[model samples]
Target: MEQHSPSIRAQAVALMRQGVPNRVVAERLNIPRGTIGWWRSEDRKACGETYEQPTDCPRCTTRDFDESAYAYLLGLYLGDGHIISKRKQHHLSISCNAPQIGLVAAAEDAMRKVMPLPSVSQRHRSGCTEVKSYTRHWTCLFPQHAPGKKHERRIALEPWQQEIVDTHPWEFIRGLIHSDGCRITNWTTRMVAGERKRYEYPRYFFTNKSDDIRKLFTDTLDKVGVGWTTLARGSDPFNISVARKASVALMDTHVGPKH
Candidate 1:
């Protein structure tokens, strides 16, 4: 048979039928890639038959799929630079969490021996593309948090981390605040000057998923690099009130520019 792309195309299609990429077939057939893509289109034109799948992907339209292409795609999605295009695969899927994506991008980057934090581009998926991302649970960088033990592991979120979280609220995103010199249990529970008791604690409130109220916590502790620790039991109410009052006072003062 002629070794033109048409012939190569037939062989390539046969190989692809068993599932193989163009680059691999190109390597196997010892054919220049121009021929790989060229003859197929030509043959399809002549025969009035086309195997090309119409992808709705607007951003990725110019590119076809294969090993190198898939690698480029995965790299692109994971934020690789060799391909000068949109690096973020920021799929609307809630599957992959922030940490997992970061870790995977980091690892794949290392394996490919490419630079970390690749450059991206302006293209977008104009049509619907159905790619799935792996989901991950939120990982506390503090790594000390066990189930229901968030209080014991108070890892101060750095300003950069807070900023990243702010940019991508899709992360295990939250705003954080810290308290200092707190006696969670021992506090004066006296309204007058006589009978009083200091006791256990109630609850610990950390920032979760609120944006407007986010800065209310993060900004309050921006420059304050210090930390505090106190153990509070469930029996303490008044002390908790005092603590909250302290927090409120500080927040009102710091949160002010209007007040």
Candidate 2:
């Protein structure tokens, strides 16, 4: 650490206390930014001040943000995202298939668009990628995050979140499909006029164990004029199927396939 005169150190601290940025103070005083930062830290400690990382969270700051990206992110969070709001570990994590690089990028972009201040990173494990944004304010954005599995608890959106989803229903649906839904093609062979013919059926499927989540998805589909039905796997009905030709076409136009 480079030593500086007491008068210079005092001047730097005064400038910092007046809300001047560290870099600005460093430039004005011809001091290293690191030294400026160290002085500021020491001053705060001497004053018994607890430092909190500044955040630009829309909810906390009451500022306008990218609601379209937020709507999409909300769908993804409900589908396959989780938040850890522990005392020391605070972050939001969205799991995506490793093969779907596009989805991974989309998830990261959405996080950054919603809250650009917090850092975002990706972790690869097994066959999936976990996209994480480090911030405790995620709970403010997604109040639905709870201690238990989503399926074991009641999941409902806040009024503000509902408004965003209603405004950008297509984006929300796209996010859901990207996270926990898929489009598949089923084909069959038939005899037509003594000739063999093949036909294919394309549909969308969204599978979630939570009844509330499934209802939310179906309700949104209804609002968008897309038809859907519930499919029962043996006894548990966890899948929402969009098989009608018109509905399939609508989904294809908006949600399409993952990646």
Q: Give the TM-scores of the predictions, in the order they appear.
A: 0.25, 0.87
Clashes of each: 4, 0
Worst 10 residues of 1 by lDDT: 172-181
List model 2 lDDT by residue over 143-173, tens digit each.
9988999999999988888889999999999
**CA-RMSD of model 1:** 17.4
What C-alpha lDDT do the candidate models reach, one value each?
A: 0.33, 0.93
How well is each residue in 67-185 modelled by candidate 1, as lDDT tens digits?
22222222122211111112332221111123333433432332233221222212224331222221111121122223332233343544634444444331121112221112233
Give the candidate number with the greatest lDDT.
2
TM-score of 1: 0.25
